[model samples]
Every structure is written in structure tokens, then in C-alpha cells.
Target: MQTNYFYRIYLLLVIFVNAGATVDSNEQSNVGVKVFGPGWDNPQLIFPSRYFFVQHFSDKRVVRVEIEGKVGENVAANRKDCRIWTQVFNETNFDFDMIIVRYKLMSDRCSNGVIIKLFDANNELLMKKETSTAIYAEECVCHNLRWNELMNCDQNSEIYNQLFADLRTFNNSKFNFENSLEEMKRRYAPYTKSYSFCHYAIVNNEIYRKCYGEYVGFAQFMDDMLISLASKTRLPNTQLIVNLGDWPLSDTRRGSIAMPVFSWCGSDETFDIVLPTYEITESVLNMQGRVSLDILSIFGRQNGLPFNKKTSKLFWRGRDSNRLRLKLVDLSKKHPKLIDAALTNFFFFRDEIEKYGPSVSYTSFTDFFNYKYQINVDGTVAAYRMPMLMAGTSLLLKPVSKYYEHFYHLLRKNVHYILVDQELDELLPILRHLIRGKQYSAKKDELPASDEEQAAIVHNMRKFVLKYLLPSHIYCYYHKAIVEYSSLLKDGEIKVSKEMQLVYTAKSKKCNCNKNDANKDEL
Candidate 1:
């Protein structure tokens, strides 16, 4: 009995000496202790089915891992063809005949995580790991931005930084005074009846407004945004036009005025200044108004099921806005257990109702978390619910579109959400891989992400929304946009017309009125 016990103890010591601090728990092996949150320097541990192990340490920017074998050449050779965005890992040392991996690449493309692989001389897979990459958290402060940081954010900042080209154009140009309020109004006249829009002027840090066309919730949402901005900082005197239509005014006609719109697509970037969509802003503000809700509570992340408990099917239900939506329903009908999708309305294609009718009931927003993957198809323009959908714990299968919202540039495909082709040809194959960890491709290199990788992607997305999409960040963006737009005024001159009225209401006054008021808006 004593010899048997000693033999078992000797085997354990030998295993420990060979592998060095075995990390088997998935949670601890992926993300470690980083107070600001886990969007940086959290390298993953991937090994074969055998008892292989490694220990890793990371600061804000660099991660160093030690492997207990002479696998330096294998790691170096396989990393290039791993297709995880090249040139991130380097073999630092071969001391004690072991490999030391020094990972120090900082890229927005690798925001989801970095994939590190090792292959033997015969090109057989030995091990693989996916490490989380750094985002703008360390450098960019989402809550507030100093005046100077505006330009700097555009130049060096990653995720959550809004581009300010129009501001730069007007701020840098010395030749001016040719374009005035009348010229802008005349340029805007041709499209007034075609779409919904409004005009506003900020005078002495107060909101004044005039509306040509009305959309049910749009005007009120804009009022709330301006009120939030006015409460935060003193506004520069300026007048601006806003587009409240479902789609951005994409006409880049000669002499067109630069108007702020909720979304823009393709070449519209040259003419339209994009702002956060009203839908996302309204949802965030509504969540903030609740007594028990906090910044991260906007998406009801607490209600989302644990990854293992979530339903393994992809889910979607919405109006048939595009032809692709109808095709999705047809595909869902054929594979009901795999995909739960149906058109709730058929206004766009009423004639086709006979074939794809019997609309499905609308699912509650919170109930969306029951499924593992959520489908996001473009509706009218960019899907207004994208930010909210992405905030949930479930993975998103988002289709490509020409339209984009203010923060669209921050989103990385297969990082924040899985990118499905417009036609969704690879949808089923991708879903099989993510749901069951089953590879569909015949090619040896086109392997599916492991279960840990899928969960890590979801974690990265939720962290992104928590860090950058808070109510404070949205308000700060509005304030910044106003400040940058004010710089365009010639001679710093701004005038209010007779039609414009002060946009003051009980709701507006309640925000930041005084310290004594318990309802003072929280930044």
C-alpha cells in the first residue's frame, strides 16, 4: 500500500513538472483579473486531447506564455497560416528546451480574440488557442471627451470613436462666408416633402426646434437627446438640420448641405454626418429611467440564460422588409427545429402572403435571449434594433448591408457578431459549426471555432456594449457632435428664425435642473 501511494504521487509530480500548472477550467484559462474589463491581453489556452498545459501572464498590452516543450518552430510556422490576422506571436526564448510565446499585437480586426496554433513537422495539428485582443478601453475614455481629444480620438482611437471629417473641413478652411442659413435651407427644400426631418438651433445652451414632417417617436427622441446634451455642457450657438427619415438622404448633389442623419450608406459618408439611431438611444434612456436599472441593464443581460442552458437554435421574427426576409422564412419552414423564423407582417409583399402567410406572433424583447443565435436582417435601412440585439448574451448572425449607424465602424465581423452573406448561402453550415462544433469544410485548415471560442466571442460583445454604449457615452457623443458642428459657423455667428421655438418641456426641465431635485438626470 505504501509503495502504491508513492507510485501515484510520483506520477502526479511528473505530470506537473512536464506541463507546469495545469489550467483546465475554461473560465480561468481564458479571461484573468483585469478590473477595467476583459477586452485586452486575455490569451486563451488550447491543447490537444492529451495532458498538455501552459501558464500565461499579461499586462494591459502584452501576454507572455510558457510551454513546456520544444514546440517553438511549430508555433512559429503554424501561426502564419492560422488565418488569425498575421504577425502577432513571437518565440522569445527556448530556455530549458521549452518555448516562450510573446504575444504583443494590438489590432481592431482581432477584437474578438487571437487564434494561436501549433503544428508538427508533418503538418498535423498539435494545439490551438484563441486569445482576446485589445480594444480602445485603455486609451479612449468613453464617458467624457476633452475638446482636444476629439481630433486625437479620430486619429488613434479604436472602437466607439466617431469620425469627424465634416467638422475638420469647416474648422480648417480659411475661405468661408459664401454659404449661409438661407443657402442651406434652399438646398434642403427639394427633399422636405420626400422624407421626415427637423431643424434645431442651440442658443445659449438651450434647444430650439422646428419640424417640417413628423414621425411618431422621432421628434421626441431627438428632444430627449438634445436635452441630455444641453444638461451636460454649455452649447455653442449654432443651427443644424436633422434627418428623421427611415433612410439617410443619399443624394450627394452639388451644393447639398451637410445634414446630420441617423444612418448613411456607401458614398453618403461624404455628405451626411451620421448620429446614433433614435431606437438605440431611446432604449438606453428608457432603461436608465427605471429605479432598479443601471448602465449595463439596458439589454437585460441578467435575464439571459447561461450559455449551456440557452436553446441551440437560431431565432428571428419581423416584418418582411426585404426579399431576403421571405427567403429566410422559407428556409426556416424547411428546417423548423434548426431555425425559428417567420414574417410578422407582409406589407412589403402583400401579394406573396398566400405562399408565406399566417404571420407569427411577435416575441418579447427579453425572450430573445432564450436562443443561442439571433438573426439581424436590414429593415428599411440598417436594422434599428442591432445595437440592442447585440447587447444580449446570444450570438448574432448579421447580414451584410450598405447602411450603417454611427457606431457601425466599431463592430468587427465574427468578433462582435457573425457575418452572414446577404444571400445566407453559408448560414446553415456556419450554424452547424457554432451550435454543435461540427466542421463542414473538407479543407483541413477551415476548422470551426471551439465551444470556448464561441463563448468568448459572446463575452467580448457584451463587454463592448457595457464599456462603450452606456447612456453616459451616448450623451457625451451628442455633446461632442454639437460642439464640432458649432465650429462650422462663419465668424462664430448663429441666428434663430421666427419659426423656431424653444424646446422646453417638463421632461427637459427635470434633467440637471438643480442638485435639490432627486430626479436630476444621471450622466
Candidate 2:
């Protein structure tokens, strides 16, 4: 009996030793942790099946999605081509800081790319952009920009360091502007004399700041009273203001809504005001308000400045999203001298057999800015390039767009952008008008004349962007808007859902503000 007991104890000890050894082996096999999150040094223990978001993001509002397949099963599914799956998450109520997704790429080569499509709570498609998963075949497949360290701007990241410096400077200084309200109104006024936009907050019965963001079509003959209220926000108030840097989730969310749109929307509970894209929806500022010029792309290359050498022909390059652009291509093919429109990525238009060309290699902003006349069109909603185009040396020509940015309200038809039809039926006629009017020539590499009407228009746009589109000015606008919106809320506080607490930061958040602040010098 004693011998039997000893034998049993020995068997149990052997099993425990084996289990410990297996765990050690698993830990030793882990790799590729520094490539992901806040830790920047932790090893990732990747198993075959489960998806893993970085620790920094996963700790916040992002949640890893669970797939109903093993590594082997996922491999089998993706063997043919890229298999895209759209999962519907409740983006409306959750104030998640970020949304990170990881999946298995059943492929031997790591160069394959995966596309993720986001949908609102109602199963409406929002936007679809592709991401590279070249490292997927190595460790894990993840959307690099989604829920990674790139989105988080903390002290650890250079972006965060810069932001912190800005915050420090902002917090250190007392709110002071050299220009009075009336002076600022005049100084920052847009090019069109009729340009009018007001932003104030309404509290109880009185008005604080007087507007959230105003849309004015006609000239504002009246001036805003510059009565300054407390700009510092208090947190205890049930009502808060939120600024969203994206368009809304769906058009269906009629009244006030709380949505989760990646990083642009802050924690649902953090702010009372939210920014996103909205056509008719009331009570939200569009992200376009905070959009900034990519300083690197604009300044890195030698561009055709105003009064410099440029082609007289109108130039435009973009993906085929609207029929108008495709029509533009068709029209341009007929008049190559006047219009220079070409497709860079033709994956979508593969089936359109009518339009085919040898892919031309061209740089982005440098190529577009080289033309005296620039064409603007909407892709999905408001095109982001319009502001940059307006800032360019080119004379603006665009279709009458139903969509508009926050700044578009102040823009006049001829002064800001020449409006055209979406069908571009009059595109050729407009080019003819330019040619006949001697505004531009239909010759390659021919620059516009100094005395041309188009040249004057180009001058106004460049001046407006250089003067009013400063990063400091934009941040002040955003900060003031938030202050006004928050104080406007009453006891009837629209409670942000729990999920709205997720931390999400917009890509332009850092750039939209003081990119050239003195605080950055300290870093």
C-alpha cells in the first residue's frame, strides 16, 4: 500500500513539471511586441487563433473582435484571395477611445493587404480604406493605424510630447488675444466681403459666445458683440460640450446622437459636443473645421507658387468615386490640352473597358500644384482637398456641391470656387470660355497671364489660406466652439452612453492645432 501511494505522488509531480516546461517554451517563442503599443518592449505571445490589440489601446475603448475559426480554418478561408468580413459593432452608444481589429491572413507571403469596411449601428457603410498587413504572415494581422501607438499621443510618442508641450503652454498662459472681438472679426474675415460665420454658446436664457457654428449664405451686415464669458469649462455640470472630427455615423440619427467613429469622436461621456460630417443634422460641427494642410506634402516639394510657371490647362487627379470625375476623364481624353485628368490606382475601374491608359507616374501635391487652374469635386461628401486647392496658386473650378465644409459657408461662387455641374456637361464649354476670354491657353506647359481674371481669383484664395488658415486660428476656433457648446446645455443633459468613454483621437488632432508653437522648441 505504501509503494502504491509513492507511485501516485510521483505521477502527479511529473505532470506538473511538464506543464511548467510547456509554459516556458510558449514564453520563449513570443516575438514582435515592441512594434505595437505603449510598452514598446513587451513580447507578444501570439497563439494561432485569437486577435490581439496593443495593450495601450486595448486598455482603453478598443475591443478585440472574436472570430469563429481556428488558425487552420482562417488559412483555408483566405487561401483564394483577400477575404473581407464586415462586423457590425454598436458605434453609436460607445465612446470607445479607439477601435482595433486583428485577423488571421491565411497566406505564406506577408505583402498581402487587407481592407476593412466600417458600418454604423444600423448596418450602414461609413467608409472603406485599405491597410497593409505585410507583417501579418509573421506574427499577427492588424490594421496598423487603427488601434495602435500611432493613434495615441502620449508623452512616450513624439506626437504626444509635442501635444503635451502645447498643452503646457496653453495652460500656462492666460487666455489673451491681441485683437478685440471686432478687430478679430475684421482681421480673420474671409476673402468674400459677404463671408459670415458666427460661433456662440446659449446658456439658460442668455447667450455665451452666441453660437456653436453659424452658416450664413448672405453678407452679414451686422457685427457680433464681443462680450467674453468664462472660457474655462467646469466638469461637474451634467451638460458638456463635445467636438467631433468626423462626419456622423449615419443620416438616420435624427436628433442629438452619440456615436463611435474611431479616434475623432472622444469618449462619449467626455464632451457634450461632437464633431463629424453632417449635411442637415443640427448641433454638430464637421471635422473639416479642424482639418489642416499637410505641411510636409505641401512644403516638401518645389511647387508652382502664385505668379510662377505653371500649365494653363486645368489639372485634377483622384480615384473614381463619382460619375462626374469619370465624365471629366472622358471629356479630358477629348481635350487633353485643356484638361489633364488621369487615374493613379485603377483597381476599381478594371471593368470599365472604355477608359484605359498606360499608368502615368506622378507626385501628388507637386503635380496638382503645377497647374494654373485646379478642378475640385466631391468624393462621398465634402472633398478635403478643396481648402488646399483654394490655398493653391491655381484658379478654382468645381461642380455645384450639395456637401459643404464648415468654412464653405463663407465661400462665394466666383471668389472662392467656380461652380460647375456634377455631370460636367459644361466642362468643355467652360474651358472654351477660358480659352476665348484669354483667361487660359490650351497649350501644354503654358502658364496663366498676370492680368487674367483667373489670376486675381487665385491670388485671393492663396491670401485667404495663408492669413486665416493658421493652425493657431483653427485651434482657437475649435476651443471656443467647445466652450460655447458646453455652456449651452441645460439640466436636460443628454447623457453620453458608457461606451462613449472610449478614447479616440483624430489623425489631424495634433496638426490641426498649434503645429508651430514655441512649446515644441522645448522638446
Candidate 3:
């Protein structure tokens, strides 16, 4: 009796399948049908997919789709070739059927994440798919102006025009910039016009008492020098004054024993006068706040600034303080002139402080240096030498160095920096290296590695990072993780069930004959 019942059910299923063959040209039609299993877990659940359908109306055609998650699959079709394919799945294992309600293809191209749909004979919706995650073979269509190119380009060249053209293209193709631009402008509106600079007042005990009393007087003089220098340099837009340290202490014990210290009792009064001149005018100020004098002193110790044992001990208080000491070893090796300036500024400030008291004093030429320093005329400036000079010179040279590369590139075309033959020989291999690393992509002949092969590739990448890119410690960590995860595949870390492979395949009638001349009997 059980066998007979099973046979009857099978007969009914066959009858239903046959009944789905009827064609009603005028009636609204549904083509594909996808039936879920008992738990509605269709096979091939491990892979991703999407469903879409095309429908025809009296006046126009429409496409409808329901997406399960974020758009994963992309649809690519060539109307001229009458071919269409989903770019997501590497393989599939299910069957489905769908009916076409509309024949007209839409003229406009859909965006990256849209779903395409089709219908079955019973007007039932069918299969769906998403684009693959693998990188595409096509080159990025966007163009960017490199820092060097931006600095060196001719104002009227085709290259300049092309750069702007690419920018416009990107704006038009990728974003609605109108509203975003306004919001960005509003966010940064507050900091549009503020800038500032700092100067230090120094005092040394070695300086005469008269010089010590005149410390505030010297600070004002130094402030005036900075202002004058700014004027000569035509940096009128700058504002702000910082009186960096050596303010008057209540007792001599409060000062460093190794170096002469001058106190400025009227430091606050002198600052008030200097601050107003440096105030921002009707404009927003964007200023980097002052660095602490203590921190400045530490920086000098680390950078191998010339300091006597007594002065170094006074500044660097602990045994491990030498670890904090910076050896100009690197910079000294690269640029001797820079090192020379560093040393000169250190001693210059030290001497100025000892001779002039902790007041403003001259250091170097206007072109070479423009910072104001307070000098203690009685004592040696050597103890506070590194901190004072390093901090001051860094501020002076930073702007020039920041723009140096840009200027260098701009002048390269006008000046011959290297022989043509030497340039070609050096450039050939560098160009080849860049082309291989930056331009190459795995595509066509180079498909994604198979599960078994990926482990070895990951291992090699980790080894390369450790061996060749050793200095880049961060990349080593990242590559190690990549290798471990990739090796999991080789270790049978994942076990996939057979039911997961049963994907739904939609069915549709293939029009073997011409549509216009099809006979009713032939169909």
C-alpha cells in the first residue's frame, strides 16, 4: 500500500509539470519557479546569489528583483551578441526555470550592486546571483596628480588640463559632490585663518646680575627681531608669540647648577605686549601649540647635542636617560651642513644667554636664522645649548624642507641634475619593478589559486615580508596571519556538506526557431 501511494504522488508531479507548458500570449505570464526544501534551505547555501525578472507592459518594459543581502553578483550582457552571464559564481549545482514577460532590454546600464531577474512559465520568480569578489582585470579609470607632478606641471600644458578633466570625471561618475562640499566647508570654516610661532627667553647664572635683571628686556628685543624677520620674509599672514621658558624662579636653587640661569620676573608682562602684535586679524587661526621646555631639553639629549657631563646630568636625570638620547648619528651622516647648523645654534644660544643675560639675543644671519633668544651674560650657555638651539632651528627649517621636494621636482625639467645616460640606466630597472608590482594583476591566465595551492603562496608571501621587507615590522605581522589562515584550508579546517552544493537552477524555454515565423503546430 505504501509503494502504491508513492507511485501516485510521482504521477501527480509529472502531470503538474506537463500542465506548466501551456502558452497564453495575451495573458500575464510567469515563467520560472524555485521551490525551497522543508526548512527552506536551498542547496548551495555556501555560495551567494540573487534573483531578477524582466516584465513587459503596454507602453514600456520593467525589471524587478528581490535582493537577499548586499549586492554580491553583477550582470553582464551584450545585446549585440545576444549573450548574458552572471559574473559571481565560479561553479553551480542546481536547476531552475523562469519565464520572460518582457523582451525589451533596458538602455541604461545598472549600477555595480543591482540584481537582475527573470520569470518562469507559471509566472513564478526564479534565480539570483552576485558579482565575484576577485579583483577585475581592467585598470582603474581614475587619474590622480602626484605631489611631484602637481608641483612641476606647466600651468598651460595638456597635462594640467587632463588632471582637471579626470577630477571632473571622478566627481561626476562617483559622487554627488554638491551637498558634501558644503558640509565639508562648514566643518573646516572655524580654522581658516590662524597661524603662530614661538620664541624662548633664556637666563644663565654665569651672566652678570645686571644682565639677569635685564632678562625681560632682552625677551622684548628678541620678539622685535622675530617680527622684523617675518616682515623681511614677507610672511605677514603669520601671528602668535610663545615665550618658551626660563621664566624667573623664586630661588637660584630652582635653576640648573651646571648652567647659568637668569630669571624674568616680568615675563608675563613682556608676553602681554608681544601677544597683541601676534593676534590673528579677522581670520581663523590654525596653530600648533607650544612644546614644553622640559620635552625640548629631552629632545636635545637624544639627538646628540653638545652638552657637558654636568649639563647632561642636570637635564637627563636618570641612568637610562642615555637611551632617550638621540644620536645625530643619522642626520650627521646624511647632511653635514645640517649637523653644523645644529651645533652652531646650540653654542650660539648658550653664549648669548651667558653674555646678554636671559634676554633676547642674536644667533645667526637673517637667511640662516631669525629666532630671538634670552641670554644670561654671566654664565656659559652650553648647558641649555641643545634644547634652545634644536627647538628654534627646527621651527625655522621645517617650512623650507617641507617644500624642498616640490621645488626640486619643479626645477628638474629646467635643470639637468643627472646625465641622460646615467638617468636611463638607473631608471630602467626601477620602472620595470614598479610596472610589475603596481600594474600587474592576476587575470585570464592567472586565476585565483586553488585551495591546495593557496597555502604555499601564503607561506611564500610571509617569508618575503620577513626576509626582504624586514624593516617594515608591521607587514610581517599581517603576512603571518594571512599564512596561518590560508594554511587552515590545507589542514581540513572546513568541512562542507553535500546538501550545501544543491543550488537552485531556473529553467526557461530555448527559442530554437525564429519568433516571427513560428507556427502554432511547430511550437
Candidate 4:
């Protein structure tokens, strides 16, 4: 019984061994992928599923595969082979979106060449690829399985849709935000009121002298007159008092000495003084004579005067002409600095003329003669003829020249209309009563029958000057001249007092002396 059992066992063993060999060969033949290159252990064949390696192969049908990462170099290849077996099993059994192949260069061998070939189950070529460079020695032990291929399965995936939508929304939001900001700025700009005041003062007075002498005193006088006429007229919201060409040279001259001086004064503030460039040039010409004309011509050219245009008169002529004079007066009321600049030019011209002779060719004699003589008399040689001509022309032109005549008439009418008068004995008593805190009252349309009524009117007038007009004038003067002149004075102390005295003396001499004597003294 023992012998019979042993014989059966031996026969069974042989059958089992033969069956195993048949199964292994069948698996190798069924493989649809192959690899060939240096550094492989088995050169003739490779079992892609089993991870068999080949040392070298010449067939282009062979595919290259690279192993990466380490499990102890040689052992790493075996471990990766095991992992690949599992991946292959899963891929073959279930649906896979795609496969990703990971490769790494190997550097152990002189030429670590790799190649791979893929075939269908029927042995027909599906793909073929190769790599000339080796997997780096450090990376040769890494394991890689195809993952990127799986991403290509669906074009309309949720991840891609979300990314595109977010990108579009981000772009649109930025565009709308910018447009809203621009609309807000247009909704809030200040209201600007424009009007021109007629500035009038005696000629040759300094700013301070005029301010104290004429402007302040005139303002008081005008206030009283307005109060007297209050029953017939209403007060203006704001008054624009323009200083026509002959504005005082000083705040004191205009009677601004008692007013409080504020630091922030300019066009943006209350009062303004405008000086004409022509007036300045005229003054300069008077002082320096003909040589000043050349300086002025050069200056005019630099200032954009049309030097070559015959239709356009010479700079000084165009400037001193009646049209320009009126314009200058208008512009001076609006822009005080321009007037100051004109005056500066005149001063410089005068200085130059005084240093040079009148016969010099700074400008043509005809230009000077026309400006000084012809225009003054309207081409009449006889004094009596000129005066008669002027008077007759004035009457004739009154209707036709309404605009010019209106301003002229207004000026003459207002010239004697004192806005403020410091010298008025009546003014001092009224001011004194107000300063001493006198209580006064008045009825609508009632003339001052009592001392208290009179005091009330004076107080109101004084208050108007202090609150509105004076501040504006002082502010304008400081910005326009005081600050600059103060800086020019050595030690930064304004020589206002000394300058005032000189101005006063000059005015007195001008008023008392004859024209010829005054001219000689000025020269």
C-alpha cells in the first residue's frame, strides 16, 4: 500500500510542474506592452505585467519605462514591479479615466537607454516611445503610476466649469466699480457770483493814502447816503467796488489804518485792487522819457505783443489807447495783481528813460507823438479848438457812445460822492458815540430826528465797513503788495510809516505846485 501511494504522488508532482510552465509562457505571450534598453537583467524578452527587465533591444516596437525612487536601489525596482502589478490588475478590471506615466532619468550605466512598445491583445501596434537619457541615480528607485491620463476623461467637468465662471465674475466686478466714482464728483461744486465794482481814487496817491484818504472815508459817506436813501432803495447782497486806475498806493492812503489785518487775503478773500499795465508804462515813460520806450517795446514783444502786425498798434499805443484804458480799468477791478504788474513795468520803463535820452529810438517818434499828443486832443492843434471839439463831440457821441459815456458820467457823478470822509466833523462824533456804547434805534422810513437816531445810522454804517468792505480790501492789499514789499524791505520790517510820509509830501507838493514845477521836480 505504501509503494502504490508514493508512485501516485510522484506522477501528480510532474503534472503540476508542467502545468505551471505552460501558464507562465501563456501570460508572457499575452502581454500588450514591451520594453528594451541598457541596464536590464533579461535581454531577450520582457513581461510587462510581471515586471521583467531586458539588458538591451534593437526593436523600435519596444517602449521605454523608467523606475523612480528607492527601496535600496536594486530592490527598489522589484518593489515598483509589485506595485505596478496591482495597478495593472485594477486598470484591467475597472473603468479608468486615463493613465499617467511617470519617468525618471537613470545614470548608473554609461548610456541608460529605455524604450517601450504597446500592442493590442491581438499583437497589433498601439503606441511606441523611448527615452535617450537615463533616470538619475538618486531617482532610479522611485515608483510611478500613470495618473495624468485620467484627467482627460471628461471635458465638461465640474472643476473646469467653476474655474471659468469665477474668472468671468472677477473681470466684470472691476468694470462697474470704476464708473460709480466719477458720477459722485460732478454733484458738488460751489456757486460763483460775478460782478464788477468801479474803483475810483485821486491820481498819484499811494495805496495806503488812498485807502485811508478816499476809500474808507468814501465808504462811510456812501453808507450814510444809502441810509438816507434807505426808504427808496434796498441794500445789495454784496458790493463790488472796483478801483479804477487811480487807486491809492497804500492802505493808509485809502484810509485802512484802523482796520484789522488778517493773514489770509487774496482773490479768494474780500477786496481786490487792479492796476493797469498801461498806467505803469506811462508812469515809466514820464520818468525816464524816450529811452523807456525801447525797454517797453522789448518787454511788449516778450509778452506776446504782435510786433509785426501793422493792424495791431505798438504795444504802448495799444495799451494807452482809450479802448485799452477802459479794458485795463475793467481788468484791474477784477485782477489787482495785473495792475500792480503794469505799474511795475511802468516804473522800470521810467527808470530806464531817466537814465537815457528822449531822442533815443526805443520806439518811433510817430508812435510816441501819436500817444502823447494826437490822441489827447483828437488831432486839434488849438487848445480852444480842442476843448470845443471835445465838448461838441461828447454831446454828439453821448447817444451813440452810450457805454463809454455812461461810465464817464458815472465816474464824474460819483467822483464827488464820498463813500467815506474821515475829515467830516459829523463822522467823528458819530464814531465816538458808537465806540462809547451808545444805545440808539430807528423806525422804518424815519429820518433821524434825534441824536440817538443819527448815532444808530452811523453805527450801522461803521459796522458794514468793518464787517464787509474793509476786510476784503486789507486782505487783498496784504496778498498783492504788503507781503511782497515787506520781504523786499531789509530786516523784513515794512517801511510803511516812512513811505507814507514821503507819499504825503509828494501829494501835497503835487496839489500845491504848478504843473511845470511838479514835472521838473519829478524829473
Question: Which candidate, 1 or 3, has the higher TM-score?
Answer: 1
State which candidate, 2 or 4, has the greater lDDT: 2
Write down the TM-score of every candidate.
0.63, 0.42, 0.15, 0.14
- Candidate order by TM-score, decreasing, is 1, 2, 3, 4
Model 1: residue 133 alpha-carbon error in angstroms: 41
Among these predictions, the greatest TM-score belongs to: 1
What is the C-alpha lDDT profile of model 1 across 409-455, one tens digit per residue? 78887677888777888788878777777776842144326644555
Pairwise lDDT winner, candidates 1 and 2: 1
In angstroms, give how far residue 380 of model 4 lies from its true place: 99
Candidate 4 residue-wise lDDT, 314-351, digit = tens: 12212222232333333334444212111112222344
TM-score of 2: 0.42
Q: Give the per-residue lDDT digits (tens) of candidate 3, residues 418-501.
A: 111211222222222222222223222232122222222222222221122111111122222222222222221122223222
| Arranged by lDDT, best first | 1, 2, 4, 3
Residue pairs clashing in model 1 are none
Off by over 4 Å in 3: 1-177, 182-330, 333-339, 343-523
lDDT per model vs. reference: 0.52, 0.37, 0.21, 0.23
Model 1, runs deviating above 4 Å:
1-160, 165-193, 214-217, 253-270, 288-295, 442-448, 505-523
True-vs-predicted CA distance for residue 185, candidate 2, Å: 39
Q: For residue 230, what is the lDDT in candidate 1?
A: 52
